[model samples]
Target: MKLPDPPLNQASEIAGDWPLHGLAEDMRPALAQALARGAAGLATIISLGEGGPRPVGAQMVFGMESRAGFLSGGCIEADVEAHARACMADGRPRRLVYGEGSPWPDIRLLCGARIEILVERLASDDDAARALLALAEAREPAAWISDGERRLCAPASDPAPTWPGAFSRRFDPPPRLVVFGGDPTALAVASLGAQSGFSTTLVRPKGPIAPPPLAGVAYRRDDVAGAVAAVGLDAWTAVAVCGHDEEVDHEALLAALPSAASYVGLLGARRRLGARLDRLRAAGVAETDLQKLRAPIGLDLGGKAPFEVAVAIIGEIMASRHGQPALARRPVSTPDGDGQAAKPPGGGKS
Candidate 1:
C-alpha cells in the first residue's frame, strides 16, 4: 500500500518551500492545491521548546512532486518532507521529534531547540480543510483541532476538545488595509500594504478616470462612506486617511472611526490634529473612538518621503496588530556632526 516516489528526473521540476512567517491563511491555499493533486500530506509542528524559529502551529503541505511552507528555517524541511511521504505511503500518522532527544541525532537544529511534528495523509475531501478555507474566505475566525488522525474545524468560540492528545489552534482573519487617498503617499501605502500581504484597497473619491497603476490593489472611487460600506470593516482591518484634503480626510475619518477597524490613522501635522478632532467631535464622533485615531499617522520615523511615510504607516499598523509599542523620539544623525532628534512629519511629503 505504499505510494511510489516521483521519477528521479522530475526532482528538478518539482517546486517547494515558501517562507513560513505568515498567517496560516497563506498556507491553506497551498494545502488545498496539494489536495487537488489526489495525493497530499500535511506536516504540523505540534510541540516546540525554547528558541525554536517557528511557532508550534506552523505547517507545511506536500504534494507528490511539490511542497510548500517552512518549518525550521530550512533546517529540517527536507527530512520532514521525507516523513510526510512515508506517512502518505502507509496512510498512517507519524510523530517526529527533532533536535534534542531526536532519533536522528545527525539532524541537529541550528537553534538547538527541540520540536515535534505530526505528519498525516490528508483525504481529498477533507472536511476540516474545507471548513477552514470557507471560514477564511468569509474573514471569520476558525479553530482547527486534530488528533494525528482525525481533524475538525469549527468557529473559534467552539468548546475545547476533550479528545486525548488533540492539538488545537485558532486562526484569525488576515490583516487588511483600506487607504483613503489618491496621492503619491496613498499609492505608496496601498502598494506597500499589498506587497506586505494585506488585503489592500485604495479608495479615492472622484479620483482619476483610470485606477492607479498598481498590481494586487483594488481601486475604489466611491465616497468615503460608500467605500467603507463596500470594504466592510472588521476587527482585522486598518484604515488610513491620508488624502491631505481637510474635508476629504475628515469625511474618511468620520466614517472610519465609527467602524470596527482595529486601527484608524490620519496623516497631518500633530498641531492640526486638534482642529480635525474638534470637527469630528462636532460631527458626533465619540471621544472613545477619537482616542483610537493615530494622528500624524505612522511610527514617527522622521521621514517625509512618500515611501518613508508609507513604511512608518505600515510599521505602526503592524506594531499595533502585534501589540508592540511604537518607537518614539528617535534621534537621527544629520550631515553635521551634531545629531538632530527625529520627529514625525509636521507637513509636506518627505
Candidate 2:
C-alpha cells in the first residue's frame, strides 16, 4: 500500500480535484528538478492525467536524452527514464501509450490502467517561464502554449483551451473545488479536499469557522460567482454540495455548472438525491451538466459516519476525475523477486 502522508504542511498541501493526477502547490521542487531535464534547448510538455497516481500536472521532463519525472510509481520510473532518454534523442514528439503489460515482455506495472502521454521536445524554459510567470503575476490574459510540433491555445476562459492533438505528456493548471456551507462535516470534507491537490476555497455564509484545524485546508467565504471568479473555476473543478442545506447547495451547484467544473456531487441519501435531481432537472441545468452532479456523493465503502462518508466521496471524486468507471479498483501486492508484480495483460506498445 502507498504509505500514508507524513502530514502535509498547512502551507504546502496538494489537491485531489479533477484534472486529477495529484498536484500540490508544493510540487515546486519536482518542477524545478524537472526543468533541468534535457538540459539542452528543449521545451517541455508535462501530460496531466487523472488516472495516474501522480497529480494531473505532476510534471515529468523529457527533452533530448534525459528525464526527471517520477515513473508512474517507483515500479515504473527506470524504464520510463531509459525510454525517455531514447525518445528525446529521436527528435520527434511522441504519444506513448503504456499500461497493462510492460514496454518489453520482461517488465510490468501491476495495475493495468493505460496512460496516453504526449512527450514533446522543444527548445524552451525562458518561454515557458515567461508564460507561466505571466499567469502567476496575473498579467497576460492567456497565451498560446506551443511545444514546437503543436500549439495549445489557453484562452483566459474556463476549460482554458487545449488542443487534444495526441501527446504523451503536458501540464494542467490546478482544478478548483468551491465548497459552500459550514457545519461539522465542513471541516472533515475540507480535510478530504486538501488531499485532492486542488485549490479549494471554503465558502460559508460568514466564512470558514475557525478555519478548520486540518491539513491542506484553505478557507475563503465569498459569494458563489465571486468566489469562482476569484479562484478561477475551469473545466477541471468538481464542485461538491456538502454544505448540507438545500438552498445553499442548490445555488452553489447551479452557479458552478455555468462555469467549467466537470463534476458536481451532492451529499444525501436516496430520497434527497431524487428530490434534488428532480428539482435540478426542472431547473434546466442541461441534462449533461445535471447528470454530472453525483447526487449520492461517494462510493459505498460501508462507512456510515460523515468522515468515513467523506472518504467514500473522495473515492468517487477520484473516479470521476480519472474518467474511470465509478468502481475501478487497484489491488496492490508486493513485487516478486524479479521486480515484476502480478503482471497485467496487454500487448506491447502500439
lDDT values for all models: 0.78, 0.51
Candidate 1, clashing residue pairs? Answer: 304-350, 305-350
Candidate with maximal lDDT: 1
Which tens-of-lDDT digit does each residue in 262-323 have in candidate 2?
77666655434556666766887776676455545566565556587667666677787778
Those runs of model 2 whose alpha carbons end farther than 4 Å from true positions after fitting are: 1-69, 72-125, 132-168, 208-210, 281-284, 326-350
16: Cα error in model 2, Å:
29
- 216-334 per-residue lDDT for model 1 (tens digits): 89999878778888988999999988886677888888888888999998887655656668789999999889878876678767878889989989998888888875453222111
The best candidate by TM-score is 1
Provide the global lDDT of candidate 1 against the true structure: 0.78
Candidate 2 contains a number of clashing pairs equal to 28
Score residue 193 of candidate 1 by CA lDDT.
Answer: 94
